[model samples]
Target: MEPTPTKETVELTTESGTLRRRGEWVVPRLLRIRSQAGAVRLDMSQARIAHPVVDIELSVLSGSIVLVLPDGATADLDRLHSPHASHRSRVPAVPTHQAPHFVLSGETYTGALRVRYARGHRRR
Candidate 1:
């Protein structure tokens, strides 16, 4: 008999201030962040990812959101709608073989979403 794969999701919500996740944290398959203001930072440089592919759903009314990925990791933000915000990415849009991939969706109003490689790490 084959075992079924369970879905894991981690959610962070706040009305203001900063929400950060760094160090040696365990990242789930799905991550959701909701904020009415302030900043949201996720440093996945040294974290343990549960899956090869990760889905992130973000909702921010103001402020900024930054995602620092490990080297060779890629992020896809095509499903994100940010009419009054800006989206910047230093990572590749396409996924690399055997590399971690992140898919971002949801909306950001009057804020910014920045995706980049970790410090001292260059794109491969």
Candidate 2:
């Protein structure tokens, strides 16, 4: 039998669209990427937020820039190309999407995700 969920799922809390982690970030309960179009971007021109439960790295970067996610959240990273990553060093493939590198199992917490982009590389 399936165990009943004891915690609240952010599946209902998250709304579609690109959401910029506002001034004082609030750690939500469940951070879920339910759809394909739905995205979350962490701009560099922001401060350290209160931390996020789960980070949904958006596939939308018209230009090259590094983004930082909230602290402690399960970061879904989308890699970018840059001088170092593109010219200086060699990267196998431009990653389209990335999940937190660890074991995940019905756990809850807060954290950040970091993403870096190269020049002229748009989110595919």
Candidate 3:
């Protein structure tokens, strides 16, 4: 008999300074981030993701958050609530068939959220 694999949920929290997650890391099914006056940079370009869809929940109080996704991966920021923040994205909002999808939902006050593909990777 084969055993079923369990999905993982990762959480990152910071009060100040910078939080960066890059290089080759295992991506979870759900990623939650909370920051206060801190900068966050998540580069999932060389990550190992086992799920088809990943959810990211963020809460920022006065800082910036940057996300660098892998090629062919799409991000959906329609559920994010950033009334006093700026958002910039170079990736597609809708995911392609069988492609990895990231759904972002969170609130930011006086901060910014930027999403883009890895360097040299164009939107498909």
Candidate 3 to truth, TM: 0.91
Badly placed stretches (over 4 Å) of model 1 are: 1-7
- In model 3, the clashing pairs are none
Comparison by lDDT, 2 against 3, better one: 3
**Predicted candidate 2, C-alpha RMSD:** 13.3
Off by over 4 Å in 2: 1-8, 12-16, 42-67, 70-124
94 Cα displacement, candidate 1 (Å): 0.4
Q: Write one digit per residue (lDDT tens) for candidate 3, span 19-118.
A: 9989978889999999999999999999877789999998888899999998888899999888799999888888887668999998888888999988
| Each prediction's whole-model lDDT (CA) | 0.89, 0.31, 0.89
* Candidate 3 positional error at 44, Å: 0.2
- Candidate 2 matches the true fold with a TM-score of 0.28
Best by TM-score: 1
Q: Write down the TM-score of every candidate.
A: 0.91, 0.28, 0.91
Q: 1 or 2, which is superior by lDDT?
A: 1
Off by over 4 Å in 3: 1-7
